[model samples]
Target: MTDGEIPVICSGKGCRAPARWRLVWNNPRIHTPDREKVWTACDEHREPLAHHLAVRSFLRRVEALD
Candidate 1:
């Protein structure tokens, strides 16, 4: 995969699409805030994923993953 390519399909349950976004996130209770990695998401699922992560304050950033 390229630097910004989605290595897998969208992680959202019951959905499958070539991911278009990389959501860098970590849970402070289990990992340091600085400890983060990318999660692939399709456009339709982007907001839901982001909202889920944001509600728990686990989101670091969202970026295009080509």
Candidate 2:
């Protein structure tokens, strides 16, 4: 293990790549307006993952990690 090594990986299905972004969202049907759900994504999976949530109107923000 290293100092900057995060244990979490991308949320993309079957993808084991390290996460480089944080997808923040809320499913209004199941959660309160302020309740947030997060999904991690690597560079490659970021767009598709975000798009999937956004089309459903669930994506709130995409935060790039250092």
Candidate 3:
């Protein structure tokens, strides 16, 4: 978020938009209960990306990109 710093980008395939949200998740089958992973999303890809994770029950929380 500073000058010369690279912006975070959405995780959506082939989409190169800057991220505005954070998707927190983990695969229970391969991770400990307290473990967490993250995916970033632009406003446009947020919903679809969240939906993909929700369907698999991998999504933990969504937060604004800091």
Q: Is 1 or 3 the stronger prediction by TM-score?
A: 3
TM, every model: 0.81, 0.88, 0.95
| Model 3 ranges with Cα > 4 A deviation | none
Residue 62 lDDT in model 2?
Answer: 99
Best by TM-score: 3
Q: What is the lDDT of residue 33 in candidate 3?
A: 92
List, in order, the clash count of every candidate structure. 0, 0, 0
The better candidate by lDDT, 1 or 3, is 3
Candidate 1: where are CA atoms >4 Å away?
Answer: 1-7
lDDT of 2 at 28: 96
What is candidate 1's CA lDDT for residue 18?
A: 80
lDDT of 3 by residue, 1-66 (tens): 899999998999998999999999999999999999999999999999999999999999999987
Candidate 2 collision pairs? none
**Pairs with steric clashes in candidate 1:** none
